[model samples]
Target: MISCSPAEPVVPKEGGGNRERGAAPRWILADFDDTLAPGDSHAGLLRYILRRRIWPLLLLPVIALGGVVYLVPSQRRRGISLIWWAITLGLSPLGWRKLVRAYCHTRPGLFREAHRLLEEEGHRCWVLSASPRALVRAQLALQRPANLPYRTIGSRMHYRLGGLMPRFYCHGQHKLLPEICALDTELALSDSLHDLPLLGLGEQGWLINPTPARLEKARARLPHLMVKNWQL
Candidate 1:
């Protein structure tokens, strides 16, 4: 799976490395997937579907429905029909969230250094993930020790019969800023090109999971921001 770590061009910083030091510490805005938790949660869900041998059968009907819909007259091809079809036939919220929570629980840390900092420094840490809050909270409970000091700021959901439908998913360039605004955090951490909005909101932003290309790109843009290698 492709890494969600943001490239340098997107990160906004003065130069390179940490500028804030001493007792005046800053809050951290962190992305849950890839940045903090290693690996793709969505990919794990897909793997589960494949292992269960359920995807092929589950998708077939959806495809058939889509084909049938496409065959309908343009006037009948309403947005509500598509929404209803997705609600009725596509991925169920229960199954999807189960996969998501399971995957999140199993995720390894991408940036140990950053996590250590958050733990040691006692920063007001909040996980800003595209994932639902329940999923993040569950993973944190399962994977990280209860002693770990942090809270999660994530997407909300709505409960349905035997499932949960996502009301909104936090993503794209604009996603993290609102989280930062709501949380009032000064620092942020992420590992993706799409997290620039969140990164820019930080007084000090750290880019995790650096590659040769990504490192160079980040250096060119956010020179002051620290770029840490996750493997270390």
Candidate 2:
């Protein structure tokens, strides 16, 4: 017969909580347009089309109508923008790619020191934008380091039945829903007050080169956000 002895108490493993926290990947959500580049990519694409193709000139009335539609309400703006895209620049994906490449070439300094710092910190970075996905992807591919792994979520366009269709419009206050549904955001970087919703989701928020009024508004909403100025 074996003699019974006092039971030893169980001890929690050292840094057990740290191990659990480390398992969850860190993600940095960055806005594409002004945050990455000096100007808005959507407006740049529109300008590119207007300068390169004469056909879009004939649709001046349609473009004007779209501009008016954009002012109506935030909910309806995406639809109007999509319609404008289809009418003006959605004729050929190949053509769009070429245009995007040409546009990116002029903006060599698109990827700034902030992006480098984020990457250096071992955080997975992604671009979230109201600009079309194709355009944003093309811009990143052109500007970012080849070895750095990054992804983009933005408005999507699909080619169906010999026409381009707007598949998704990731924008405005609702921009974070589509992105955060799949991944957790550790940090967020943006230049506009429009990204307030997205900035609110991040564990850390960075406002880059925001105007004084916009900065004040952001501070009121997210007082903890880190402010930094970046120039093109």
Candidate that scores best on lDDT: 2
C-alpha lDDT of candidate 2 relative to the true structure:
0.66
lDDT of 1 at 224: 59
Best by TM-score: 2
| TM-score per candidate | 0.63, 0.80
Error of 2 at 78 (Å): 4.3
Q: lDDT tens string, model 2, 1-232?
A: 1111113211111121223654877677788788867788777777776778777677677677767677665545544564456455546877767777787776645646655654574247777888888777777666655633366788886665554545776775647564463555677788987777667666678898888888898888678778877764
Residue 228 of model 2 has an lDDT of 77
For all candidates in order, the CA lDDT equals 0.57, 0.66
Clashing pairs in 2: none
For model 1, how does the per-residue alpha-carbon lDDT over 1-232 read when each residue is reduced to its tens digit?
1112334235343323554666444466788778777765533544554455443555455435744764553422232233223433345667665666666645664357645755664346767776657666676666555434466766566654432334555664436443355443467778875565577666677888777787677656556567756752
